[model samples]
Target: MLRVGVLVSGGGTNLQAILDAMDQGKITNAEVAAVISNNPGAYALERARNHGIPAECISPKDFPDRASFNEALVAKVDSYDLDLVVLAGFLVKIPEAMIAKYRNKIINIHPSLIPSFCGVGYYGLKVHEAALARGVKLTGATVHFVDEGMDSGPILLQKAVEVKPGDTPELLQRRVMEEAEWVILPRAIDMIANGQI
Candidate 1:
């Protein structure tokens, strides 16, 4: 089985989708071994606890510096002996050392079709806001391998969601998450877990 460690920084709706997929047998040959978040208040941790999955908080705020925090984060990830790491709305920039260690073993779920509203300064609702401001007719989500660069990894899967007329950023964000993010993220995880990637 593929042991996965999930990193999150928010409500973990994507994480929940993954868990739900696993529960419904949509994903095979894998199991979530642990969940970690930078925010102690993150509901992702709570979700993990409810599922009886090991959860931890290793925030940069708890460390003296970024380096120390990175080291600790790496140590925490290593402790799980994970086969894969998924960033499900994890807001923190991964340490270069961790990226090197995990290499292609790490993947992320971006809010938009990458190479579009992705890269630096684009995340969460900001991505949807940009899409709305640009008056895009279509927006989507992407699952991709994580590299040293910002959202510049090789794409694995993508699914587009429509941008409707008079849609606000928040509404579009929700639609993208429900229609695209929630769907493809789990599919990507299943693909990776089953060695189809």
Candidate 2:
């Protein structure tokens, strides 16, 4: 099995999609080994528990320093013996050492199609807000290999969603997530698991 460890910081809607896909056998060669979140209150942890997967919270605040927290994060991820690490709405910037160690093994789901409303300061609803502010007719999501730079990784998959008139940032974000993020992320995981990527 392709063991996967997922990191998240929020409601984990994307995480739920992955779990649902796996339960439906859309991803046959993979199993979610664990779910780790920076927020103790993150529903993702609850979701993981509900599925009987190992769940943990390793917030930076719990450690005395960022370096310690980073090291702990690395160790925690390492403990799972994961073949893949998925950042599904994980807000933390991965530590340099972790990035170096994991290299192409890490992948992230960016809210935008990338090279657009991506990079630093463009996350969550902020991405949709920027797209709406710029009056872009099309905005989407990207699943990419995680690199040292923010959303600068090599692209794996992308799917665009239409921007409707009178759409608020929240509405647009939901649409993009449902139409693109939810679709391509699972597909990317399956591709990797099946050695098709």
Candidate 3:
């Protein structure tokens, strides 16, 4: 089985989806080896614990620099002998060194289509708010390979959610998240597993 490590910074809704998919045999030949978070209080940790997966925190504040924190983070990920690393709602920008180490093996789920409303300081509710403000008829998620650049990786998969005329940010966010959890993430993982990505 391909051992996978997940990183998260908030409530683990996406992580939960991946866990459910794994439990249901939707993601063949893969197992979640560990979950790591930068925020000690992130609910993703709780989700990982509930699944009996090893969960850990490596706060960026505790490290002297990005490089040092990344070193420890890379070590933790390596300890799992991971075949893939999934960033599920993880908010920090991983250092270039760590990105170089993992390269194509790291994947991230972005809240919007790439080259669009993405990059530094764009995540979670902010993404949805931007999409709504832009009068976009459609908005969704992107699952892409992680590179050193901020959300500027090669795209793996994308799922679109229609933006209704009267949609609130909360409603659009919920819809996009549903597509992300049930569609985009699974397809991306399957593509990787099948050597299609």
Candidate 4:
């Protein structure tokens, strides 16, 4: 079995989706070994705990600088002996060192279809807001390898959702999450774990 480590900083809906898939046997080769969150109060931590998965919160504020924070995160991740790292709603910029260490072993799910409303300053509801403001007829999700650049990694999978008339950012975000983000992330994880990537 492949040991997977998840990184998150929010409600962890995507993380929940992956966990559910695991429970349903959709992902047979990988198991979530641990969850790490930058926010101590992140609900993702609670979700992991409810499922009996090891979870930790390591604040970047506890460190003196970005490098030290990254080093600590790398140490935490290394402790799990993970075969894959999945960033599900993790908002921090991964340090170059961690990127070098994991290479293509790390994957992230972007809210937008990527190369679209993605890259710097485009995360969470901001992505949906931009898409609705631009009046795009369709917006969706992107699963990709995590690299040094901001969401500039090679694409793994994408699924588009209709923008819908008069859709608010909140509504669109939910649709994208339910219709796209929740679907492809686990598929990508399964693909990676099964050596199909």
Choose 1 or 4, whichever is better by lDDT: 1
Stretches of candidate 1 above 4 Å error? none
- Which stretch of 10 consecutive residues in model 2 shows the poorest summed lDDT? 111-120
The models' CA-based lDDT, in order, is 0.95, 0.95, 0.87, 0.94
Shift of residue 62 alpha carbon in model 1, Å: 0.9
Q: Write the per-residue lDDT of candidate 4 for residues 107-195, one digit (tens) a residue.
A: 99998887999999999989999998898998899999999899999999999999888799999999999999999999999998899
In model 3, the runs with Cα more than 4 Å from the true position are: none
Task: Work out the TM-score per prediction.
Answer: 0.99, 0.99, 0.95, 0.98
- True-structure lDDT of candidate 4: 0.94
TM-score-better candidate, 2 vs 4 = 2
User: Which residue pairs clash within candidate 4?
Assistant: none
Tens-place lDDT per residue, model 2, 1-197, is: 89999999998999999999999999879999999999999999999999999999999999999999999999999999999999999999999899999989999999888899999999998999999999999999999999999999899999999999999999999999999999999999999999998
- Which pairs clash in the backbone of model 3? none
